[model samples]
Target: MKKSISNSLLLLSGIIILASCHSKKQLVKRQADSSAVRTDNAASAVKNKINAIKSKQVSFTTFSGKAKTKLNVNGNSNDVTMNIRIQKNQKIWVSITAVIGIEVARALITPDSILVINKLQSVYIKKPFSYIYTYASRQVNYKTVESLLVGNAIPELLNENGKLEPSNGNVVIDGQLQDLLYKLIIGPDLKVTSTDLSNQSAGQSLHIDNSAFVQADGRVIPSEIAFSSTVKNKTIQADLKYSKTEFDQPLDFPFSIPSRFSQVN
Candidate 1:
């Protein structure tokens, strides 16, 4: 009788241990399945956001705006008023005025060339469009600059195969362009909130933040833009706040370099 009782207790103990191990395994499996479901849902959300942005392309022949601009280069800051005009892909004209409302510099940017006239110094710069890249990242171009001004994603990033994930209540798209790593943060409304581009090899990075959106011509436009860049141990920052803006209006872009101004190399 004693032997039978001991045998029965051992059998019961073995059964309990096996059941506990099986329960643990089942719990782990369930957790993994739940995690995968969450991942799939997040990915689907990102895909939908990307498609929505691609569908709504702001169509306009002309864009113009007035803004107060603050520029800081190497700790020196200057406040100025800016008048900007854009004729689609053809031209971008900008005039910079001082506190007295006197225009001190004007710039005209085209697809192939860039022209600038400085009234204060009596100098003009005429160079290939690539020249602007010297002051900015190598990926800087006409479309990139225009997109930055209007708070849109660059064509390269949008059209590329990128990895999308959710972070801090925003969808982030990450990709590489021209040997640079780029991250674009998109808000819930499918508008881009900020862009970050980094070139690890050169130790350079560019950050742009857009906010204060307003509806114009059935599209949302950013009213404030903050730009910061670091290149070769030097940093420059610019803040632009738009006071007035209009789109799809017939506009004129007039640019003529003063003949007497010396050309800068």
Candidate 2:
């Protein structure tokens, strides 16, 4: 009778151990599955956010604005007024005036070419669109310039090379697009707060801050923007505050260099 009782107790203990082990395995599997689901949900949310931002971009036939501009070049600072006009996807015209309302410079930029009139020097510069590369980085294009002026994300960066990361409650999209590493910080309101681009091999970088939204033509637009670019150890920074903004308005981009002005390469 004693031996039978001992045998029964050992059998019961083994059964209990087996059941506990099975329970533990099931619990671990459930935990892993839950984590994976959470990750998938996060990825989906990020994709949705990116799509929403793209859809909400401002669309218009024309744009005109007056900006209070402050420029800094190699420690020299000047305040000027910039009257800007844009025929969407066609041309951008700018007239820069001194503090006393004297026009000092004007520029006309098209998809293929760039022309500038320097009133102070009585010189005009005409070159292909690639001329911009002399001052800015090689990654800059016509679309890039248009997007920067309007606080829109770079179209090239929204591709497979970009990754959206959430850090410290900020949404940052960063990746290598071409030879440049770019990061675009987005605000909670889904607008771009800032953009940063750098090329390690070339020692070049561009930084832009976009802020102060104003509504025009049923669209929100950035009214304040700051740009800083460094190329080959030279740095240029400009801060623009838009006091007047209009969209879809009939605008004129008249740019004609004077015959007396000398050509600059």
Candidate 3:
């Protein structure tokens, strides 16, 4: 009887041990399944957000906080500041001022053409959109400026068939061998995410949270945009703030040149 009792006790111990081990395995499996479900939910949310942005017909005014490198007779350095404006339907007119001892530059862009009237030079350079995009990277962020002119964001709005993935923490949109999506989230008061666009080239990144939001001409506009770019080994940063924004105001889209500004390209 003593031997039988001892055997029974040993059998009970073995069964308990096996049960504990099985429970642990089940717990691990449950945890993994939960993690996968969460990941799937997050991905679905991102896809939904993209769809929402695409479905909307949005008109907005923007304030920009910009940092950009100005290559000049002097040397390379940083400039930052605010610009304000209203933009819609591939047309924008903005006056940009600077901080850090730099002068303001004013610009107007349309779908077919871009007219940049320089306050410092007292000169106006008008050119086609394609020509400007190819040659203008040296002056401004070619991708961002192009998107504003078209009233849409690239890759987000243009590269509809690009690869979307999460890198680090931010979502990256990549196009055939070129990465066209980059953005930074900022925190402060104004609460905005600034973005840098390369449109398939190596680009820049920057952000400011407390930029500005302004109402203009019956529409809401982002009163500030912060930017960063790398043109060579140098990094350029900038802020653009718009004081006035107007939308649905009548102007020629793909604006035609007055004879005075007309020269066949």
Candidate 4:
């Protein structure tokens, strides 16, 4: 039972890539017409649209959500309910519950450390943040994780020099950051519809698709998110459907390993 709970927690952490941070920028008006004719200065228009999308990024000191998550890996599938909370640039807390609402695992992630307690096994794992790079790619970090969870442009991708192009009736922003190539698709509503990040030399790729945007606290946020990644030919996928979410709400992050529990590594 402990092994099962550990595996489930590990899988959830890998799939969620949970992290948090805050940034403020200007919001650009949403482009309502997808069929608008492109002018000779289409490049300028596209750049403006990308900028607007970045500007409207949601900023909050804290966030909390209850989600139903489905994870599939190498042909096996599992469903779990996650209670997640984020304190920008500080920590991410998650509780995983299994059958009959029994709490099985809890994780607390910070900028410098990762900690998970397997209540079923009475064991815990404590490692540095760098431990996550082993599961995904070297490009996976706190900022990227945070951005991915909230459906915002990754900081590294945003900083890179990029080109704007048209693809399948939407605007595609392409760029290379370090060894990774990224293509971001932006819709007429100025929201990101999808993002693809690939490192050809490493044969690793991460793709995220978001939809079902609804207004929350005066900000538009994606309620449905799909994440998929292929690392060394092993594929992992997760879909998150947030049922309740809010920002700036007072929340408690309680974590204490029982004295009887033993540490693993």
Candidate 5:
């Protein structure tokens, strides 16, 4: 009788394990369905917002404000503070200062090219703005640059032109923690997922919301930006307040390649 009882116990344990596995599978399926629904909803909302922003007929005059950026690459980190100004024809001026040394760098950008003047080195480099991604060390992405200027992603700015078609890729903003990606294709959607923000000292994740508002000049811009990113195991955060915007000012591109400076390809 005792031997029979032991065998029965083993059989019951096997059944329990099978039941647990099946339950886990069901949970995973439910989670995936929820995620899919969330993505669809976010995509739809972004489309509506884009349409509304473009429907307005006013041209913005000028926009200016302060911005801060922090980057972490393979454990090394740096912080930068910048003053940004933009004009209506997509002319942009950005003055960046390093946080540790206060080393100032200036960049002037037009629709065609970008000119970067390094005050610390007293040198200037001219290239296509898109090329900066390939050359700069510990450089931020173009999307970050757009965010710094207008609290919007680069693709959103392009969407305003009605000629620039969105791409079919997603960017991992603030690194892998938040799992948020902006889908430029399909419908230019902003999809957000879970991110680690608990350890502020360890660089919290960043979450970008889809809710943007039009400025007084009728240009669509993000009113509130939630910035959370981890850099060098350091928790840094800021609520960037932007105002006093002006758009459509004329900016003469004042960058010339000096023969004296060594050419860097």
Candidate 6:
């Protein structure tokens, strides 16, 4: 069970990637009236729309939240509690606990390295950021991970390649970056609602949905978030509901590796 929780927490930090788009057709082009001129680009309004969506991302110096997580990895399902803390663009801390508040695992991630301690097994893993990215997607960076955790749009999608399309009340942007095709949906209030990413040749795809929203720390964010991803036979899905959250609070990141613990590569 500890191993499963370890895998769950480890992948939770790694699974968030900027590769979101449904299909080439959903994102690329849509049917247009014959009399109307078509211009995916070449419109200044397109830039304004993208910028407005970016401006809605949450801004904070420090954040803390406790989430009730339902996690399924490799067909094994588990219910656990997650205590998450983030110091803006600096570091992210996470603690996973089971029933009776028994802490089974803890992890700390930074821009340069990653560290994990499995209390149940007396083992630890320490490696560079590349180690986790190798299993997930290279497109995922520290900033994207931080943004996704708080229901913010991934910065990668707002680049020059982003093509804004005509939509109703919500804002939608889609484009292709290398082999990764991407799309982003922003709610009427300018918060990110859904993100989809796919790579047909690589047989990889991922989706994240923010089903509901609420006021947290004076900012509106997704109260419930769901993630579903598949790569070949491996499947991972998780749903998180924020039970309590705070922002800009004084916090501590306590990490001291015990000598008795063995380090795993």
lDDT of 1: 0.64
Q: CA shift at 76, candidate 5, in angstroms?
A: 2.6
Candidates' TM-scores? Answer: 0.80, 0.81, 0.46, 0.84, 0.44, 0.87
Candidate 5: residue 91 lDDT (0-100) = 64
Runs in model 3 deviating more than 4 A are: 1-47, 55-57, 60-87, 96-105, 135-194, 199-224, 233-235, 241-265
TM-score ranking from best to worst? 6, 4, 2, 1, 3, 5
Tell me which residue pairs clash in candidate 1.
none
lDDT score of residue 222 within candidate 1: 64
TM-score of 5: 0.44
Tens digit per residue, CA lDDT, model 2, 1-265: 2222222212211111000000011111011111111112366766666776677567778877777777665556677777778788898887777888888777777888877677777877778887656555567677776676666787777654467766554567888867789998876556677889888787777788876566655766666677776767666677777767777888878889888999976
Q: For model 4, what is the alpha-carbon lDDT of residue 205? A: 80
Prediction-by-prediction clash tally? 0, 0, 35, 0, 9, 7
> Which scores greater on TM-score, model 4 or model 6?
6
Error of 1 at 58 (Å): 2.9
Question: Ten consecutive residues with minimal summed lDDT in candidate 6?
Answer: 18-27
Q: lDDT per model, in order?
A: 0.64, 0.64, 0.33, 0.72, 0.38, 0.74
lDDT tens digits, residue span 9-124, model 4:
77546544442212222223445455343423366665556556677677888888877777666656767677888888888899977756888899998888888998888889
> For residues 1-265, could you state the per-residue lDDT of candidate 3 as single tens digits?
2222222212211111000000011111001111111112355654653454343223444322222222111133323222323343344444333444543344555556555544443434566555443322322333344343222343243234544554433344434323434442211211222334343353332222223444344422344444343433434333333323334544432323344542322
> Best TM-score goes to which candidate?
6
Candidate 6 residue runs with Cα over 4 Å from true position: 17-41
Poorly placed runs, candidate 1 (over 4 Å): 1-48
Candidate 5 local accuracy as lDDT?
A: 0.38
**How accurate locally is residue 258 in candidate 5, as Cα lDDT from 0 to 100?**
56
Local error of candidate 2 at 123, Å? 0.7
User: Candidate 6, clashing residue pairs?
Assistant: 19-197, 20-182, 20-183, 20-196, 20-197, 21-196, 21-197
